[model samples]
Target: METYRGEPAFNLKGLAAMAATLLIWTGFLLSLRSGSQSVLTTTDLALMRFGLPALLFMPLLLLRWPRIRRIRLRHALLLMLGGLPFFYLIALGSHYAPAAHAGALVPGTAPLFVTGLAVVVFGEPLPRQRLVGLGVIVAGVGVLLGSGLVDLASGYWRGHLAFLGASLLWACYTVALRILGIGALEATALLCAGSLAGLLLLLAGGQVDSNLATAGWPLLWPYLLTQGLGAGIVGGFTYGVAIGALGAEKTAALGSITPALAAVAALFLLGEPLSAGGLAGVLTITLGVLLASGLRWPRREVQPAPAREPD
Candidate 1:
């Protein structure tokens, strides 16, 4: 066990949890990209993303219903930023861009967006290092968008924009979490339940397409495991555990490699080749995330000598 401030910093359990989180996050991008390649629609992917988690969390939602009902509509809407709308953008992005772009743009740039949100919404002061990190992130994103522009016919820029939108929405969700004053599990349940309702409404109105029936079990089971169980349930739980054990700054720093991992995995697993520009973007964004997160090793405190002259 590593200690910080006389308490456990990074223990085996926390490290294991962080590892699980990284795997799930990588799997999430791959799964969404795979679904986009298949007959499944964004609506179908959205269903998989929340359906099982919502079902499993139903009882918990009911238990917390009284408190939940008291929440303001504004906060409720903010919380939903992480739900259907976010997923819809991400799924739409997958249709146009390779998983590598998403790997670079979504999670890679989330901290930048979150920092912007914090400064804007909460009036927090931006530190110089994080400011520089944000600038670097912008440069990296420019490279990514420029890469997409090389083949305008592919319409990859549209996907890149959607991924950025998803990142912003996720940032909003992160800000909302601070003000919402709810446990992680409760928030997850609330968002999933609400998103599930919206999904049903959208389905009923024919606002989105669905291919769950046509896709069959071959497509559906993997999604259920990756989207619902792995990303939705396990990832969130493990992230919370990691945060508790390693603290948020270190956990975020460790998690920043998700884009690089996803990009490499997609190269082999999904047969998506990373262009030089995309590779540069991923590496740059990874460095930016580390800087933006202000990750630093804990320094031992030096104790001052007692007043010997008084004796």
Candidate 2:
């Protein structure tokens, strides 16, 4: 067994957080999927998701405000591509496809996209297994979308493409996260502040409020909880803990279950039916996730540094 400052390496709390991250992601998909069905626009969902949570993170931004000038404006704009852009695009896509599709498309293809980018941009090697996984994923996405292609002129394909775009944004976000090496809270603070700015801009133009008024409070309140509290705050913190404990690769690999989980949730929560192709697509993509994940469970029992009682 591993040790951390002579204590057992098993951190049950961190493990719990990892599981929470998985559940939160699954729920996030469901919430957005369900919420988009309401009168709310993609812009409305984005505002509630980030804007409502702005206060929780805004204080952190103020505390770090003095050092804000040290960061580049260009980098901040790139971060927006990851946060609000990613969220609204998927929310917009969800309006067209079911949560099941968002679950299948977004997380399913993101790593493959990242792997391809890494190979091209950073000279990273594409091992045989990862290459095969990528092929399987391509096939899976084809089968998933294959039936729908016949109706492309009707614009259903646009939603699927939007989800794909969202995945690419996420791949970029993962890349950005690595380059920045910032804390979980710091990244969340920046993303929230940035998204809030965009939301405010839209609000000033009167593009977001009328829809919210018509959507009504009953429908809007739950979305507020799921996007703002659930995904925005809880998902961020738990994923950070999971990454700290399980290593980024393994934790991300474990995210393979998200789509399947989301599919099940959509069935029960939204009564969304899965066609035969959709079912097959889900399994195929899951297989692809396993192959593409580059899974390496840490075997060496290295001693992690002792956990500290904060001063």
Candidate 3:
């Protein structure tokens, strides 16, 4: 496998990891949208989102505590961006907007946010292809948010803004993952543990109430599987693997397809139909992602004729 800085690059394993992350992220959006419609509060959903993974990874986190403690506070906070704060915004957005909007605005705009961060914060040069791709993505996002901007009473605009915020938070997390050079599993453990601790503190302080006890098993089980296990554990780890293998820009760019998948899934499963604007936004964002990811037809590497018998 080709590698950069000890991390795999453009390899099959990373691609597989990204594929898994896509499915899990799609399910995560759907589940969050469903949870919004349920009796569960955003806090309730957040608890489940972080709880199971924290429990499952507690031992691992304990073992790594000494090393984890040495990480700088700012860096640690950045790594935790994918945790509660991110989930809260997503949950809030899901309450107001259909799953399609969340799907479109969050993952779809990630490449723009990530690339901008790279250029501004990391001082990386923006290639012409990536710059053009980002412009396309911005146009797509404008489509998604255009209707919301005019419909203030509907409150969909609030959700759109929250989704954009969540995307930015996720971008921070993605970049931090590359910067910290931590293993995916270890980072997942830390995020879950820290998020759960914060949730528990919130519960203790009466800042948020829990519905886990009253929500009943049927509704809660699906969330436990999708949010707790799938997103909290599986999604986090696979996303990290993707970043490590594909680099942050490529991972986020490829993830742009997530909006379409989630939007379609939401249509079938949740009966959330996409408007014309949503459809246009999804397609434009996807095309831009292909460009931003630099995907191309695989060419057979031509080998030069063997050296002419030392002539």
Candidate 4:
């Protein structure tokens, strides 16, 4: 086992990764908020959700076209199926739920799901400390929601369910990444391909369209820029890199901070008030994450082996 340590460089990279993840999510929230302000055509929403992913990934596909072509059809289908529900849920659920609530809940439960899946599917050991950590994090999220921390009372239960469903889909995606032997670059490319397929499905189902005139170029710009570039392209690439370097467990552990960060962003950007319950929840979640990452306690001391007599 690779024991965890406070390596300054790795820590710095972890922080950067967290920041990038937070920024990506923040951008998504901002775009979603903006999109909701007006009448959104299906095309506009699809473009906002997938345009950047497609554009950013195009060059990667071109560069590795032969390799991309060589990917097995079944594996490609699996990736597409895994990615579709996640994107669809977010797009639909945001219409009914508060962005802050969705933000807090999605990332908050993801680590727990990942941990559980690891144990069940991979036969990974469930350390007691990690379990405690997961409990603490869940308690924090409960406090955050139960106390109207993000005004979650305004959302319907159905919307919350949708977000949970989305999280599960995402968990499946993460696990698939591990099982499928998909590297960071290839995973990213596959994600883009999957997203495109989903978008096409949405279109086929009459859930979206491609006419830019209905959405208007002006109103569509922010969604395209933020969702496409900030969230889809840059965010996906950064997260893929983080997962590659840190492994899924630690990467997901580090991601536990995203909800708290989203809460902070909501306070500043969306003028959402920071309540006492919210603060407590943030603390609880943070502590939980520290515990889950095996960082709360002091490192074990390694005693040197006794000096041996000359052989």
| Winning model by lDDT | 3
Cα displacement (Å) at residue 179, model 3: 1.1
Report how far residue 25 has shifted in candidate 4, in Å: 1.6
TM-score of 4: 0.82
C-alpha local distance difference test of each model: 0.76, 0.71, 0.84, 0.68
Q: What is the lDDT of candidate 3?
A: 0.84
| Pairs that clash in candidate 2 | none
Model 4: CA > 4 A from native? 1-15, 41-43, 69-78, 147-155, 209-211, 216-218, 295-311
Clashes (backbone N, CA, C under 3 Å), per candidate, total 0, 0, 0, 0
Candidate 4's C-alpha lDDT? Answer: 0.68
Backbone clash pairs for candidate 1 read: none
**Highest TM-score scorer:** 3
lDDT of 3 by residue, 1-311 (tens): 11123234456778899999999999999998988888988888888888888999999999988888887788899888888899889998898988878877888888888888787777777789988887887777677555665698998988988999999999988888888757898999999999999999999999988887888888888988899999989998999888887888889888988888887798799997777887887788888887788755457799998877754
Candidates 1 and 3 compared: the better one by lDDT is 3
Q: Report the C-alpha lDDT of model 4 over 241-291, residue by residue, as the tens digit.
A: 666555566667667776677778878877867688888888898898888
lDDT of 2 by residue, 146-167 (tens): 5674576657677789989998
Give me candidate 2's TM-score against the actual structure.
Answer: 0.81
Cα-based TM-score, every candidate:
0.85, 0.81, 0.92, 0.82
Q: How does residue 236 of candidate 1 score in lDDT?
A: 64
